[model samples]
Target: MTAQGAFEVKLEPQQDTDAPAGRMVIRKKYRGDLVGVGIGQMISKRTAGGTAAYSAVEEFSGSVAGKQGSFTLIHSGFMSADRQTLDIYVLPGSGTDELVSISGTLEIIQKEGTHSYIFHYQL
Candidate 1:
């Protein structure tokens, strides 16, 4: 089955370094077909030439399409001088409870200053 949802997230700075890179914690509250919260940590940096990169790991505790459980999502993204891209996916064997067999990819979309998620998955 496919589960779909939308979420709003907040990013809070957690650590900083003189190397021009730092880390932050992320919190998310989701709605739609999936309901719950997500928490994660992210590390980000910018290159001397103005490119940015980030990696993060997030655990989502919620119910998807009515199945209650939790899973971890890994993210790797970068914004070059002229382009940007992101990849988010469920970590293998990271599911628990009702989501024990979950596997999927999540697409984050931003338009007109709004954000949403497209979660494509299976159990």
Candidate 2:
């Protein structure tokens, strides 16, 4: 079986001044009845001139027959001044937990232009 859908997400930066950057807690709720569970990874980099970029990857398992299907997601990109572009990958699962994969990228346009380091995510 195959399933497809789109989602909107909101992010908030919890700790911005920590080394290697702090974790941005994500709270995403989808519309469909299907439920999903997974893990995610985030990475941040800073330059000499106080510029920074960040990326994230998430792997999830969806609800299935008395169980749940699984997926692996990889999102990466850079942010400069305020604008950002993120590349996303979604890999669907097989019976054994791996199979077909779909990928896409999202252009994140920052409305409030500031370097205060408070980021918010909404989906």
Candidate 3:
């Protein structure tokens, strides 16, 4: 099963640099024997060479295979200098779906200064 989500991201200035800090809120819906909706937040800061690092926390609310459970995710990832690539690690999490707890990578492209990130999950 594949999950699809739309995210709204906001960037704010932090005292550290000329580049802004970022926050992303995502709402996702997945289709399967058990359907679900998830909301996640990512907090990011700019690093050297126009790159950025982020810590993400996510919460899921729904039932899977008639079993209702929730989980929290903590992950870290870095964005490339050109903002064209993002590498992420899904770290460990308490959840029924162990497959979700895996490493992932993302590719980001900027259009008019707004970034579009595409994710690739690795188990």
Candidate 4:
């Protein structure tokens, strides 16, 4: 199944933790076909060639297409000089309630300051 929605995100800078050069608390509000609030933490580092990498683990609780459940999302991303790679997926066995066994990937689209998502998954 597939779902499409818009999400609002808030990033709060955290104190210099032992993690990396950058740390933040991530908060998200998802709407449309999927509705939920997600909270997580992110650590990012600057790499060579003006590139960067970041990783985060977020837990989202809500209803997807009318089925209620919660799941975890793991993110891995890297930026190159001319391109980027992002891997955002639902962690295996992380689903709960009606979403148990859910596996999928999420793609984010940002344009003009608004953020949207395409979720492809199997339940």
Query: What C-alpha lDDT values do all the predictions have?
Result: 0.90, 0.47, 0.52, 0.94
CA error at residue 26 for candidate 1, angstroms: 0.1
| Candidate 3 error regions (>4 Å) | 1-20, 81-123
Instruction: Give the clashing pairs for model 2.
Output: 8-123, 9-122, 9-123, 10-121, 10-122, 10-123, 11-120, 11-121, 62-69
Estimate TM-scores for all models.
0.92, 0.47, 0.45, 0.94
Q: TM-score of the candidate numbered 3? A: 0.45
Sorted on lDDT, highest at the top, how do the candidates line up? 4, 1, 3, 2
Local accuracy of candidate 4 as per-residue lDDT tens digits, 1-123: 999999999999999956657988999999998899999999888965689999999999998898899999999999978989999999999999999989999999999999999999999
- Residue 96 lDDT (model 4): 95
The predicted structure with the larger TM-score, 3 or 4, is 4
Which prediction has the highest TM-score against the true structure?
4
lDDT of 2 by residue, 1-123 (tens): 323333335566666675666566454433233355445657678787666777776654564223444555556777677675666644333223322332322233344551111112111
Q: Evaluate residue 83 in candidate 3 and report its C-alpha lDDT on the 0 to 100 scale.
A: 54
For model 3 the local lDDT of residue 35 reads 48
Residues 69-100 of candidate 3: C-alpha lDDT, one tens digit per residue = 55554557666845543344334455555444
